[model samples]
Target chain A: QKEVEQDPGPLSVPEGAIVSLNCTYSNSAFQYFMWYRQYSRKGPELLMYTYSSGNKEDGRFTAQVDKSSKYISLFIRDSQPSDSATYLCAMRDAQGGSEKLVFGKGTKLTVNP
Target chain B: GAGVSQSPRYKVAKRGQDVALRCDPISGHVSLFWYQQALGQGPEFLTYFQNEAQLDKSGLPSDRFFAERPEGSVSTLKIQRTQQEDSAVYLCASSPDGNTEAFFGQGTRLTVV
Candidate 1:
């Protein structure tokens, strides 16, 4: 199986809605999980990063990881039009493995005003 | 530079023509990486570099693809006899350390026709 798998979603949500993006990985060695936002013509920008299992919150965004299930998720509360973009889930192995990140096919989000 | 920078934001080359893409990472960053992003897909790891030493290149598709960071700052990815399949957005990212969050460049969009 591909290392990381994410649904390619062109999900449309109204303003002030709650949005959730998720990814699954088959590699149990992956220890670093990250979420990135990418606009139409720009590169991916790091958003949330977490290590191991548990939850991390930053402003209106929250990241959760479940090592046992090998699943990771990003939740956006009160998502706005500005949040309309592609969301990419990326992970890396423990330090000293491979520094290069493994990414999932991004989910395109369109938060309409 | 303030962030990772990449040259030739957009490039169009005829099939079989070689192409060279450049990346200027953030100063003092120890880890550098190259990734390929195709339409509707997330970026895929291509290679990784530590200073002037190329640590991992197993992600490269084939021998026709090569990358180098001769000076430990400026790097180049060269695709020899580029094919249509080689057309994709090439991205460069860097982190202060090998195990931290990374910053990405605007990316070099290569279109091989």
Candidate 2:
């Protein structure tokens, strides 16, 4: 099994709808969780970052991590058409001075007008 | 530009031909990373460098895949004899340090035919 697993959903929703994206990791040593958004022909852009387990909010995005369950989530409120992109979840262990990140397959989201 | 930059934007190579992709990281960044993103998948770590020193290359898939940050700035990923499976987007990212978030380049899309 892959270290990190995510449902590759081509989820389509209307504007203003709430979107929830999730990923589950099997590694227990992951301490840093991150969400990245990638558009066509572009690199992944960091959207939200969280340390260990807990919740973090930024603008219309909220990220949650549950170390106990090995799960992480990204919630988008008031989603817009501009939000259409691939959402990727990535994690890294706290192996001092190491910055390697393990990533999920990514879920494609499209918010319609 | 303030962001990381990758060259050739797109490359098409014949099977068994060698190819090299270049990345120019953000100025003054200390940590550089190389990743491979296959179609419909998330980016996977390939190698990492701390300045001119490659500290981790455990993610490289084969001996044909080689990366080097010769001057601790601009780095290159070279494939000795490319195969169809080598077709993917090569992403380069840089951070101020190991403890900070990374900034990524648009990436170079390589197609081996």
Error of 1 at A59 (Å): 0.5
Q: Write the per-residue lDDT of candidate 2 for residues B38-85, one digit (tens) a residue.
A: 999999999999999999999999999999998999999999889999
How many steric overlaps does candidate 2 have? 0
Best model number under DockQ:
1
lDDT of 1 by residue, A1-94 (tens): 8999999988999999999999999999898899999999999999999989999999999999999999999999999999999999999888
Cα deviation of A27 in candidate 1 (Å)?
0.6
Instruction: Sort candidate 1 into its docking category.
Output: high
Per-model TM-score, in order, reads: 0.98, 0.98
C-alpha lDDT of all candidate models, in order: 0.94, 0.95
Task: Give DockQ per model, in order.
Answer: 0.85, 0.79
Docking class of 2: medium
lDDT of 1: 0.94
Q: Which lDDT tens digits does candidate 1 get at residues B2-113?
A: 8999999999999999999999999999889999999999999999999989999998999999999998999999999999999899999998878888899999999999
